[model samples]
Target chain A: MHRDGRAFAHKSSSQQELPMSRAYNFAAGPAALPEPVLRQVQAELLEWDGVRASVAEISHRSPEFMRVATEAEADLRRLLSIPGDYAVLFLSGGATTQQALVALNFAAPGQVADYVVSGHWGKVAIKQAKDYVRANVAASGEAGGFRDIPQAAEWKLSKDAAYVHMTANETIHGVEFRPEWGALPETGDVPLVADFSSSIASEPLDVSRYGVVYAGAQKNLGPVGVTVVIVRRDLLERAGQPRADIFNYASHANAGSMLNTPPSFNWYLAGLVFKWMLAEGGVEEFARRSAEKARLLYAAIDGSDGFYRNEVAPGVRSRMNVPFFLRDDALTAAFLAGAKDAGLLALKGHRVLGGIRASLYNAMPVDGVRALADFMQDFRKRHG
Target chain B: MHRDGRAFAHKSSSQQELPMSRAYNFAAGPAALPEPVLRQVQAELLEWDGVRASVAEISHRSPEFMRVATEAEADLRRLLSIPGDYAVLFLSGGATTQQALVALNFAAPGQVADYVVSGHWGKVAIKQAKDYVRANVAASGEAGGFRDIPQAAEWKLSKDAAYVHMTANETIHGVEFRPEWGALPETGDVPLVADFSSSIASEPLDVSRYGVVYAGAQKNLGPVGVTVVIVRRDLLERAGQPRADIFNYASHANAGSMLNTPPSFNWYLAGLVFKWMLAEGGVEEFARRSAEKARLLYAAIDGSDGFYRNEVAPGVRSRMNVPFFLRDDALTAAFLAGAKDAGLLALKGHRVLGGIRASLYNAMPVDGVRALADFMQDFRKRHG
Candidate 1:
């Protein structure tokens, strides 16, 4: 199929051809890009669609870029099955900015915004929300070291809560919510906002279930700079207080995310990614591949006879991020060095969590996971 | 020199090459990028520094991308000769965000932040600021139809102003502050915050003269997403009340702009641009080339004998944005069509202005300006 080696073959012709042994990056994003999308970006970097200038060098207000922006939003909506009532905003400042924007826009003065603290990102969101509204922690997995999602029954729903915020996947801890919308505790009319930064587009999403689904594009999407915010159109009317034009969601939606010149090049690249995702059978294909990849890696860890261990509960394990540790802490440097030498890159966990985290976003090929699993077995045999 | 034709020659080898006749883009911004920089980006788009992943795909936390970020800041500091006491931040959300940050961070409740409303952008800054602080318009050129900068002597200075704000160049109105630091009205110990979005790096700047200097990279710097903010270190101490982590300049500066994963790709590209500027003899060369380009275009307008007219006063004419008009407004469509056919693109003025604006930023080669001049003269001959 053209989807497989054709993309890799095209890349070889470029001045920056891939090395003989291309490393499978597991960097937890800004992470690995699909080979096809990267090739498309390279092919179009100088002159997009017969335009003499690179997409980055053109005005956002120009017809050329506006078309790209429009097409991108269309493709995204099609992929997510977004309803007509949702406004998909291609914005700057990533998911962190969205954390604050959600609070500032939805939470009125003296109102509480419920936050389910599963891991680091949820905690950060709560901290940022505190500056704007009363951030109420309705449920916290921190007491259990964020190894699993807290039970929905344990969630303390706030009657006067403006919205309930949750992180769909915790990258650092490799904890993820099971992809079942019905599992969420009812919050009546209170909107549900999910930070899907790590796991967006990895599976089929029921867009109608959430009030807002926001993601930073560095993970499963595209590069950094561009952030996707899919918000219920009616929610914009509830936007709290007059704020900076850039921070105000209503103004951004009104301007079609062109209130200020958008990150044009990033937006264009994201469009390419969206096109690639559609061509590859969309999110269903990704979900299948992601589940298979995670199963293979987890089996390898389980079979290692205590050589390797992942702390997250099996039921809540992240298909995207697999964080594990070797039995001997002193062997960390050697493990990393050996992994790099074997053409596996960025396998080191985040600094906050000192171990190995192999993030398998949608772009991560199944073969890459196989390679990592094989490496684990070989490493265990030698080191054990 | 390797700087000249090598870049263009390499670009032609790509699948998406420039046409036989390349157009000179005159969009205010996202504007023209240096051809060499674009080529460098294209060549390295898929693999940077022997890494298999595109620069965008790599983790911002990775040593590979961290080096890119560090080198970018270092090159920018070298190019601008930034002082030790200033923290240079590479942030997202553009200069519009800074307008609010400038007010929110610097101004306490009931405190005033004086703004000089020179043109459209200044008016916008005032509007965004009013949400956060007492936005005092110390001076305005609206009465003069934005034909020139308001005289410094006629300015009102506030005794207890948090800061004084101004736009160094207004892209929409083709107005600019005269390049003389001494001409600025004294504000005692109050900080001078300038939105150098359109004019930054056009000339050598004394970083010590202003408390904060911010510019969106889309203009002369690079593509959109990354905004360069050089702020005095002392100002970090008075960062008003706590706000969103991304909105707080102090937090951004402290994290070295890595708070919640920065726009790594844009930062890397901006670094490439900074390096290109340095290789082409830094800001002084840009200033010299900019002057020559603007002179050619302005002279062409003046020589049109009433066919082409610019309303700005001769003394304060902008060297970056040259907005002019056709004597017969009915011929606007024909003028634009002809210009496009002649390889002059994005010449249509801002919708609000309803004329032609030929923005000559640093990347615009002198030859591009000469081509535009020739096209303008030919257009006048046929239309007159």
Candidate 2:
């Protein structure tokens, strides 16, 4: 029923043209989606899967929607290469809620949980978990304005820590733990939990290395309302603390994440995205495009000869979010307005870091980034 | 861009025909929405409000989206005639999650909370709150199989109860605290909290009467992901319990429900619903339609000489959900299959109470109920 098959025919190429009124959106989270996925959703807005009703209007427990839910988890499992030992949960409340849940589900009441802070999201993770656990900031980059990840030797991990938490990538601060930043420290028996909200599925991930990988499905994933939590099955056995049955991960996992009515429309949209990602050759292909996109954009900023500046250290620059500032900060408003006029939307920086931030998510075509790079050069030539 | 304005023009008239392939869907919650709203969504799936992107693809914090959020709250306030002393919150996670949060936000740790159990959802509220509060079952209809709400005098409220909790309507048991049932008890200084998930806007509501009124948007509202919570402003001062900041209601209220990334797309859809409700004459119009729809279906059931049966007591019978049984239980499969062929869908019963159920929320047109009534009579004539 989709009317636009031609748009997705060449999925990986940087040459595809955007549809009319569809701009190169650079918003972080609640970000852009693949045109083909949006087309499919529009096509089936009235009748879905021969059910004679919209997917959003059907019962989540209906056999028709249960099939949708099952296929989504299966496709996500295949896309991420998640291990069989890991149970995938499609939940609501975004990553912040999951931040609190990780502590309530895995840590004993008032037990110490070590946190390796790298940026704004890392601090948020600690803020959410502190009430449930004795949150210990094992390491922090805040001292340097979160420009880089602290050296692993600087971390003062607790001997009796319940788990070591980290933000895999920070959306606002544009900081990430790249391979060059050094491998995450081995916590021995203590499991490592990472918030991969902005970075999951942007590259191939080693699922077996961590105890829990949770993300709000808004950035590299499809939508904003649903969250995906990949937990090692054994972690479900932890009787961490007294919480409601609705707050229990094991209970949700046992019920196939249908302990209550889920965000079915968001989950279904994520499923469409999963199918698109698989069709575009999964995380491995995304990694290649991501590297290419990041290299091009970083090269443009670095070649500007101080016309533009990105404060993040080169070693840990986020491939997903590239936050940069013009040499004259007063010109920020003109740059954003000019970009919007050029059909580049949501280029304004987040309130936490007020400059220009372009988020290159999986749905962002390589062409979109190229357009942004071209726009940056054009703006620099005009203002320099 | 909407192709069919004709469909919605005669919205309240039973003579209006269903659109092609559109069935009379009766599934509870994640239920059928107004066709006009779906048409608008489909028309704007690619570009929304000149933003050059789908509403789903924009940042919730952006001014474009902030306007949508604010208008939604304002329209809802106008529709419900909510007082200035109330605070409205648009949150993720459904009614079940709020059931847990109510205790964590309003009651002291291990403090007594009174519960009036009318149906399955009431029992669920207690289950979610038992860990955080001293749950006192002040009254229960379980002894009578939840066929009716107990008399107001039968309630045994605690002297120092934090709040009195009740489900405004029972979706599964086909029971409700209808006006004919009786006025609610006066709790002196204690506030009354109600779960209005299945019946919120179906009639004119006295918002000032309840301390907190919460409903998942899936049923009578709009979609499945977002929830609307209205609380008396005075209740925000309670210490409640030590919980994560994300779980705190006061924090969400103070942040304008944008404390983190909200379910923006769902909230926008709900905003569309609010506008439609206002345009179609608000809660007063819905109340008239609900009474008419409920009358037609119940008359068909009662008119049948034992062929169709609804066990809910007439005084407390829900105008929203009508559950019934066929005289010959073995014909259940044939009845459901026949209904599906006749374009009357989701007639299958909830697993909790195994029998056919038809939910007539605000969006379910009176004509759809008339179709179900006619189909029931035709089936009885052929099967009997």
Candidate 3:
């Protein structure tokens, strides 16, 4: 089960006796953490780094916590190959808050921000953006049932748009924009803001390509409270006039993300997860394994004889979230129940698109996907 | 040390061996957590309630998490004696975010929101509110060097003001609005909003008096990241038009604080804290203990003839945060260094104040205060 030789025996006594038999959770976000990271957190829960206080109890201003925060930002920057000119902000409120903040900070008064609406997240972003500025849906895939990403050529990107916004990966629809798909033609000097919540750290990314890239640290990162925001230094100048200090990116950057009391414990855990990623050969290895995991699960669905189906286009199928359906809807309940019984949990799809979704985030071991594939085959043989 | 007869043997092997010696953290916020809660978290870090996943790994939508969230809210309601008409929201971005959100939600265009500028936090709130509406300072303690809460008679209550805003306790200045100070006159219909960040859960209050009471769950509650906002149901109707979903109070209320994936682990920890509070006889006992803790520490400062002093008016001195000073300014650094060496962590005052502050939050045991008092007496004797 250990792929990177990075797996060390969990030192916590409670972790040792817990039956190694555990569920392979597939919940979308606030999802499974790397087992080692969880163990490390557990071990350090009572006393962190020989300090008497739990990481959660220490003051964010204390040197001990400041070290954790600085290291987290440094590791994230290193992992992403982020430039010195970019500010790495560990913030709260996840991507949903960022959706509004991005618009508030960048969408200038009387200026349009072009939005490429690909899936549920994109739509949500646009809805939030409209509250602050002219949120123009330059292109939308709703007409095509969000099965695929719309071509850049199809987007009527505004010539003078303040910025261009897109969801790099949509967890609900299992749609992802590959690096090539991220290329917007001839939008002169307009910054690109990407909500990389579900896909961040799952693969290598060109940090310089986007003006802003934010991800909730729930899926591939560590926990739910903290968010990783990598914003190009220059874009900070474009931050709209006099917003709430908490919502102000510049304020956070200036204060080292301790503008107010940060989610200290979450930030520390995220640092641990980042270190684990580095030790395990970085995001490149994660990309390879993530692709393989997606392939295995997709292959199971595609190979099924009219039993299982995935609607996302082959070219843009997400490598992290693989959403599929049982062709005979009647068997879905049985399939999910059996999956749960077999230690496969949270396989149910979004309520809007009901069937199943296997979120294969970085922490989701390849064997978990294989187990799901094996289960899909058995279920099809039993009912198909 | 186990005053409540609740201290259990530290069964975790790691805890059993670590020198039972630990520093007393006197951080203003992101302060101490109950020792028992930390141990419980350490024990349950990997498997929560026999579930084969860490609490952090579980989905917020999962039935198990829903129970935690629901119970947390119920216990908080019971502890605060919150009226049924109040919507208890577990949010993120801390009190700083709520300051802006309150302005965004309650400040109507062209309408003034009266702010009682008592200290640093109140002034900051007033400044943030100015961007959204006419933030009128009805009363200010700044003229008095923030030494005391202004009399209600001195407040220039605006008859048509949108809302009256105040900080129930100023952590930095160590001034608090006692119950009598909180009663505003001739502003019958105008909603009173209080930032109870540092003092919340330290005592019981008549919750129906305020339209909105918000606290960052770092001081007396649990950890950072999660903020508890208890807003009257009627004030929700006044939430201004078309705001960011995350910033909208109604959005959180309608979603039961799950508008987006909440900080689930923080929420769970907060629930544990609420249970701890209940087990320790709720806010009433905390209030009694808090008063006693403050009394002990203040006595040490006051009894030190010209050696140690606190400028804050005795009538308004905060029971949660006690900011003090060494009369011999040159000895301040030595005082802090000696305090830290004696295992009193974060005893230094905030940078702006440049002296000493001993925050006595609910989790701070009376023994910790006694130790601090004894240390203060010894240090004064040596220096004098």
Give the least accurate 10-residue stretch of model 2 chain A, judged by summed lDDT: A1-10
lDDT of 3 by residue, A1-384 (tens): 001122111234544565644588898988988777776777667667656677888888888788888888888888888999899999998898999989888877647899988899999997777778788899998998899988988898888888899888999999998754556555669988999999999889988878999999999897889999999988888858457777789888899998888999899889888987887789999999998998899899889976899988887889888888888898889999999888898899988798899899988888889998999999888897
Relative to the true structure, candidate 2 reaches a TM of: 0.95
| DockQ in order | 0.38, 0.37, 0.35
In angstroms, how far off is A335's CA in candidate 2?
Answer: 0.7
| lDDT at position B252, candidate 3 | 87
C-alpha-based local distance difference test score of model 2: 0.91
Best prediction by lDDT = 2
TM-score of chain A of each: 0.94, 0.95, 0.93
lDDT of 3 by residue, B1-384 (tens): 001122211234555565644578898878888877777777778666656777888889888789889989999999999999999999998898898899888777557889998899999887666778788899999989999888999998787888899898999999998764555555688988999999998998888889999999999997888999999998888857457777889888999999899999999989888988888788999999998998899999889997999998878889988898898999999998898778888888988798999999988888889989999999998998
Q: In Å, what is the interface RMSD of model 1?
A: 11.4
**TM-score ranking from best candidate downward:** 2, 1, 3
lDDT of 2 at B376: 93
lDDT of 2 by residue, B141-218 (tens): 999999988999999999999999999999999999988988999988899999999999889899999999999999
Model 2 CA lDDT for position B316: 99
Query: Clashing pairs in model 1?
Result: none
> Relative to the unseen true structure, what is the C-alpha lDDT of residue A143 in candidate 3, on a scale of 0 to 100?
91
